[model samples]
Target chain A: MPTIIEKIFQMHTEDKVEAGNTIWLNIDLRTARDFAGAKVVKNLLKHYSSEYIEDATKTFFTFDCNAPANTIEYANNQQICREFARKNGIKVYDVGRGIGSHVVIEEGLAYPGITAVGTDSHFNILGSVGAFGQGMGDIDIAFVFKTGKTWFEVPETVKVNFIGTPSAPWSAKDLALLCVKELRRKVLGRAIEFYGEIVDELSLAGRITLASMVTEMGGIIGFIPPNREVINFYSKRSGKEIKPVYADDATYEKEIDIDVSNLEPLIALPPSPSNVKRVRDVHDIKVDSVFIGSCTNGRVEDMQAVAKILKGKKIAENITLKVVPATREVWREMMNGEIMKELFNAGAIISHSACAGCASGQIGMTGEGEVQVSTSNRNFKGKQGAGDTYLASPETAAASALTGYITGVDEI
Target chain B: MKVKGRVWKIEKDGKLMDDIDTDMIYHNKYLHITEQEEMAKYAFSNLEGWQDFPEKARKGDIIFAGENFGCGSSRQHAVDCFIALGINAIVAKSFGAIYKRNAINSGLAVLECNALDMAEVETGDEIEIDFETGEIKKNGICILKAKPMNKIQYAIYLAGNLFRYAEGI
Candidate 1:
């Protein structure tokens, strides 16, 4: 009778808990990133001087927001993190390792029924693989580092069923955008459990693409019960059998059903990720740049989709197409395949695996008066840059790059 | 449990603004600064029309916003900037999940008033909030009702922060 999140919480706590009850739960994995890693360490030292952390083995520092230290400030911050991790005997996934959340997944640090907390707002992406992930502030993360636990209120869960399959040119990003549009502000401060045949058919990458955008909907976390593909991935990595967790016979606060059959490639306009519109309605908007990577859509399958569209085709002149793989593992996989060559031949500037445009000073930051079509989540003003950003799928970004305009995949 | 302060209504076109994201409250470009005093100057630096907030805000000022205030990013700077500016409390129709938790854990007061949009409150108006009774009074007159902090949030607020609360426990 417990939802996935509730069940995960029960596993971590000694007493039974329900919605609206705030209780402390033991943490399995605690992580911080370059963006706030130094602050976390500073806070930890400020409050608890030189005290041994609760569990150094479960703690990690990942540097991906500004990989390779673009600015002096970032370099100093990364140095602080490294120094602290060295002294504390904690792991540090340094620069070029890609986004911290994706690294957690690739390294198999998080699994089903586990609780992970980090300094990233999108750490809830772990929910795609059926883990309970929450992003907290530096102060809270520091406390978690010191105590190996944090207090959380169990949120009521809403069940969302995705019925019917989306055809070609309508990728996982499109489905995610449609979900954001339909469920905007409705799932605020609540957990969401994704269901239906469409969810079952989605690959692990596809599931990640959908679960990552749950933040835009103001959701606490969106869980897609670990599918067979997710279980197999973790089992092979750990060399142990993985058990799947499901929300069997669980009660929900609300239920929403979305039919993906009629959905088309969609784009989120500037200033808001929920400001969604069909690609056909606002086609041919001249784009200055196209960013084809981020935690949201930087998997190998996303790269393959872009490669298939841009093969033997040159991108439009004056259009800078920036491609970034999600992690070193994804980058290595692309290098061994033809995806790298296809994107390179199409004149895309393939940079190191990192959060390119999502974070400041990265490769894909747009200048003032520039228009960028990005695969990353969140196009909020002053986020990617002063320029306006439209969120789209990999196929749409590749197609738009070819024509120097916001063109849908169907048109190309 | 009573807080009285001048109001700073976050609005546009004569209506309360919704979805005021963290980027608008404290832009990412200023994320490097960890000091509370340095962060104060950049509050609302990226928001359109509110870029001068840091200049106008005074100590003990309260902010009134529409639904989903502090919507995007889990950046604690958004909450820290307001605290740096000496804001006493924030009353909104709703708030982002992470933003709400960040505020409570950081010892900042946040109240939810569903009738805030309909309340007759304006910038510079002096209002008093009674957390014990969920009463909101403007100029000594009861004007609206707000949802007070929950048990955990009030406990954290009393203890200064999550760290101090844990120490006592």
Candidate 2:
């Protein structure tokens, strides 16, 4: 009668734990990004007074946010992480490696049944592959670095069933947006286990797109139990048999059914990710730029979606289309395929694999009075820039880039 | 333990504001500042109508916000900025999961009072909170009640922070 998360917790704690119980569980993988890596190191040394870490092999420093050091402050912070990792014999995924969460997944550092923690708020994206991933502050991450253990209040699980297949132009991002709109604030502080036919048929990239926005919905993590494809991918990558955890007679706090047959491509309006609207409902809104990247929808599948829409077509004259792959691996994959050529020919500014629009000083930063369409999560005021941001799928972003306005794929 | 302080209600349109995200509390542009004092200067700088919170706030003042306060990002600076401002406690309908943990780990007082918004209270109202009994008293009259800190929260609070609690253990 244990859910997937409960089983994962039991594996880490070696005890039966229930929801609402706060218990300490051993951490399998710990990471800090450039944004807070320096503070984590400083706090760890200040408290422990030694260069000793609990497990150097399990610890890593990832440089993705503000990759390549846009400013002197970011440069100094990345240097601090490099120095600490050098002294501790820890691995560092240097700049241009892309988002830390995606890097970990591609490297097989995070997989099904494992528990990983990072400084990124979207680290819960690991749930796409059935891993228990959490984001913490620098202080909490520092403690985990020293102890390799952290206490967590087991969140009650909510089962969300995605029924029916979404037609063309309506992709995982649209489904995710619909979920956010329908289940706003209801999943707060709880875990969501996505089930049903749509979830089972969804690809790894699709699962990631859905799980990445769980944070925007105020949920702890959104888990899509590792399907056969995910299990096979990990087994092949790790050169070992991978066992996927499944909920057996597990009871959930609540269950919600979302039918996508009648759903259209959706977009999150400015100021909040949950403030969603159908793409057609708000069409023709002039857009200054469109960004296709970030941990949310920067995978190869997302690139393919964009390429499919913009193949042999040039974007609008006044529109700035920025294309950033999620990871170096994704970038390499795009380079070997027609994705890059199509995007380049489409007049898109292909940037290095880094968090572009999501973080400041990147290629996707919006100017005042500008309206941008982004594939990344979160569009709160001043998040991308002083301008307004509309969160959409790669398909919508590509379509909008071509028209210089917010346009659904079907409209074009 | 009892905490008495003036209230700073985070409100909009005559109602408590909900979803006061971390970016609103501490904008991402100033994420590089690691010092608590430096973080204090930018508290609520991105939030509309509260851009001058850092300058107008007084020490030992308590904040009242609506549901899901501190909802975005896991940046501890959001909690640190308030602490740097010498805030007594933050009473909200609820808090973001990571934000709540960051608050407790940093030894900042965060209470959940569902009725705080409905109570007859306004900014500058004097209120006393009894940590032991989860009581909120305004002018010696019980107006609302909040969820007191749990065992782990109280222990960490008493010990100053997670690091101190770990040392004592």
lDDT of each: 0.90, 0.91
Chain B alone: TM-score in each candidate? Answer: 0.97, 0.98
On lDDT, the candidate that comes out on top is 2
Q: Model 2, B19-43: lDDT tens per residue?
A: 9999999998898888888899899
True contacts kept of 2: 0.70
- Model 2 docking category: high
Error of 1 at A363 (Å): 0.3
lDDT of each residue in B14-115, candidate 1, tens digit only:
988999999999999888777777899899999999999999999999999988999888788999999999999999999998899899889989999888
In terms of lDDT, the poorest run of 10 residues in model 1 chain A is A236-245
lDDT of 2 by residue, A80-105 (tens): 99999999999999999889999998
Return the lDDT, model 2, position A158: 91
